[model samples]
Target: MNRIINPVIPGMAPDPSIIRVDEMYYIATSTFHWNPGIQLFQSRDLANWEQIGSALNKGEINLRGTNTPAGIWAPHLSYDAASQKYWLTFSHMVNMAGREFNADSYIMWAEDIRGPWSEPVYLTSIGFDPALYHDDDGKHYVAILEWETRTGYQAPGHIVIAELDMDTGKIIGAWHRVTKGFTTRGCAEAPQLYKRNGYYYLLLAAGGTGYAHGVEIGRSKHVFGPYEPHPSGEPIITSSPQHLFSLGDPDAGHFEMYNPNSIMQKAGHGSLVETHTGEWYIAHLMSRPLGDKLLNPLGRETSIQKMQWTEDGWLQMKDGSNVAKMETEGMAGLLGAGSVSHDVFDDFDQQKPRLHFMTPYREQQEEWVNTTERPGYLRIHGQNSLFSQVNPSIMATRATSFKYELKTHVQFHADHYSETAGMGLYYDSNNWLYVHLTYSERAERMILTVLQAKLGERMEYVHHQVPVPEQQADLKLVYNEGFADISYRFEEQMEWQVLLKAIDVSYLSDEGVNGEPGEIGGFTGLFNFIGSVDAHQHDSFADFKYYCVKNE
Candidate 1:
């Protein structure tokens, strides 16, 4: 039998909420600052997963001008057996300035997973990470983290629960404040309710979202009451099992808690499910930092660990340890991982683009990107500059591997220097490294140039430029351990020549951006994209023949 690998879903897919309906498993994760709000994935064998669709595919909410890591937060996916419907609840965090996390939560339902979802019903703006639970007694409840803004209080406030009227999206009674947390690892959030063996269990993510992150558990006889901590008085699962000096520090990159013995870090924010065979497992968020450094370019990913219920009626890791592993036992009789591949080679021949493609800030305008107009090619009509939060003609996918190569062939005639089209690595509009084809008055032809934005500072490195005789060129970027090599070739038959080699891109991680030490940096990972820019006029377009990505 084959073994199961960690990170069932990789690259910026965080705060996973999972559910099992019969033999099939479905998960929903947060997609911050991306157009299609919540990412939904499906799997059968627990080892292989594929993206089916997004929950918020339509234009219900506007994400224009949304800041880094502050759009759609944690999304909870639950199924009601009686009603035969699937429910999804999530928070749209608008702002996080001055630690004032103002957000509005909403709920929606559908009959099928790939669904015509119901319109979003407003919940509240009290906090983030809202979840809906349907009890056997036909009652519904909502759990959230009531954010505390006043001084002299526990930093992130409490985990509260209340009866919810599903029809009206309103709370029926006063909010009942549960325990601040079961232990000293504060910043308790992402509350999930589970029932097993006559007890209502509350699972939370605590110790912030840095190196000290973990998942803790508590139980109570009643749905909303005084919950009791686990017997261990510590996190039930974590990447770092040992205690750290920075317990209450809100900093993101808590280097003190880095577990040198483990490959996974920041394991927390989990959602649990039980298989048809009565086996237990938890899908949680984990990160793999650059070798020995605090930098994480791939962002938080989704990982799974086998779980078991102890004799004392508490859930714990199957190994009786908190450290997350790279490989684990597979489901019984599951022979092979499925053939759903993450790598892409789109030749612009399909009627609809691949499911993994996503745009920034707003939804993709069909007029700007079209494949029907030009057969066998994707034409991107340039709009605003990449720095603008409004309309940037960019199509991207997650950067899934640390050692990978991305290549795209494009044809564009640049009348002025303002028009450019090519491929690059993008974190956001404000932070990216682009190698594009643009008009160069000095060279009097189409030339390749590099543009970089590091923490809001934009600069054009002129030395990494080469003149091309033809209007069509191939752009390639290779990334390895926080360093990127940019190269280009003029023709399909020509050999690739290096333009920039071993450029330090460690600053593209969450710790490198300029922001508040603890609360400010970007949480989204890197992306590989093909885009265009028309500063002079929005008429110039680029025709892309193909886009391919492969792990090196």
Candidate 2:
């Protein structure tokens, strides 16, 4: 039997919501503050997946000033057979201060997956990770986490369910409080309801989103009831199954729960799907940290597990192990067709950037970024500095592998100190490592240098500045095991000169930043970005001939 490697859809694909629409399988994952939000992928075999398109590309919502891990979360995708449409429900997290976690849920539909979706209809402000379940009777129900704010109550809140009017986007009845979590591990969220064999199964993500994360389950005869937990009294799937009882713990970074022996950690937040052949499988979020540091620069990724339903109707991993595996049994004859290439080389000859490229905190607009402005080159007008949470003119793609080479050729001229353009690695508004080109008044020429931000503190590598002779240059970054080696060369020079070598950028990982004290600093993974900053006049722009990424 062919083996399917874990992380079928890799890099920053957290909170996976998987569904099968006939023969094709689709998965939608949380995008957080990245605009063109709600990354969607389609897979034929569970082993390989391809990004088809995004759901929120039409500016349905504004994410300006959105904090890290606080924009679009937990996008649930479902197909309505009665309406013959695809339904998407997700939460827009607006605030995380004081642990209020203020969020508003919305629902939308589309006749086609890659589509002009219907305008977002307001759903509720109950909590995050809202999912829409369509029952066989044509009735619709919405299940979400009812955020608890009481001083002593269950920290992250309860999983609640209610009838919903699909046409008006209104809750038809009172919200019924179900279970806080199915197991002793707390921080339950991402509730997705499914019916199997006359049983309503409620799947939830427990033990926060860190090392202890896992998938827990409960079932009931009715849509809402006192659901019975799995008979094992534990998570059906997890990376670390050493029995953790972290009830009432709201912290998302459970670093203490890291399993040293497991190659895949933080494996949970699963979405279930049954294949056309009736084979059961689950698409879940997992992370591969760098070495033993437990620093996940790629953030949470999507993995698949072959599942087996016991005669008693309980779900379990096929091997009867709660521990997530790095490799599992793959569907026969489907492996070869599912393979996809990760290499990308965009010459900007087209009208728009590739669908895989995403911007932060703002929608992609032609006014700030366009290819027509300069034929054969993508022009991006500088807006705000990378430190700003508002608008940053950056075209970025997820860092899909630990070892990769990112290459780009850009032409930019900066007159002021605040004007700079180049490419580097980004985590959020507060953390990044940029190797940019800027004009040095003292040298009366363009200079290249490295700037880094860690925990919101800025550090400049002024010693590594290299004077450029022309307005354009070729830049490259070689990343291997959390370290970056930056190189640059002029068009005339065939050899690439190393400007910065072995720069330990491991701080760009999720565990390196500081968030709301106890919670995880960030959930989105590191991104390889080509951006420009014009804090001086917002008029400077960078024209790039091509952008390329080759994964090793």
For candidate 2, give the lDDT. 0.91
Q: How accurate is candidate 1 locally (lDDT)?
A: 0.87
Per-residue C-alpha lDDT of model 1 across residues 1-552, encoded as one tens digit per residue = 667788888788999999999999999999988878899999887888889999998987788888887899999999989889999999999998888999999999999999989989999999999998999999999999998888777768889999999878889989999978776778789999999988999999988888888999999999997899998888998888886543344335566788988889999999999987788999999988899888888888999998999998999988888787887767776787643456878999986677888889978767888788788998999878788788888899998888999999999999899999998888887888888999998888899899998888888989878887889898899989899999888877889999999988877776666557654277778888999999987779999999999875
Give Cα-based local distance difference scores for all models. Answer: 0.87, 0.91
Candidate 2, run of 10 with poorest lDDT = 331-340
lDDT of 1 at 149: 86
Per candidate, the number of residue pairs that clash is 0, 0
lDDT of 2 by residue, 1-552 (tens): 677887887788899898899899999999999989999899878777889899999898899999877899999999999999999999999999888999999999999998778999999998899999999998999999999888978788999999999999999979999999999999999999999999999999999988999999999998887899999999999998989889999756888889999899999999999899888899899999999887899999999999999999999999998888988888755644445677778999888899889999989999999999898999999989899888898999999899999999999999988899999999998899999999898898999988999888999997899898888889999999999999999884579999989999898888877675556788889999999999998889999999999999
Candidate 1: minimum summed lDDT over ten consecutive residues — where?
A: 244-253
Question: Relative to the unseen true structure, what is the C-alpha lDDT of residue 162 in candidate 1, on a scale of 0 to 100?
Answer: 96
Please give the RMSD to the true structure for each candidate, in Å. 1.5, 1.2
State residue 375's C-alpha deviation in candidate 2, in Å. Answer: 1.5
Provide the clash count, candidate 1: 0
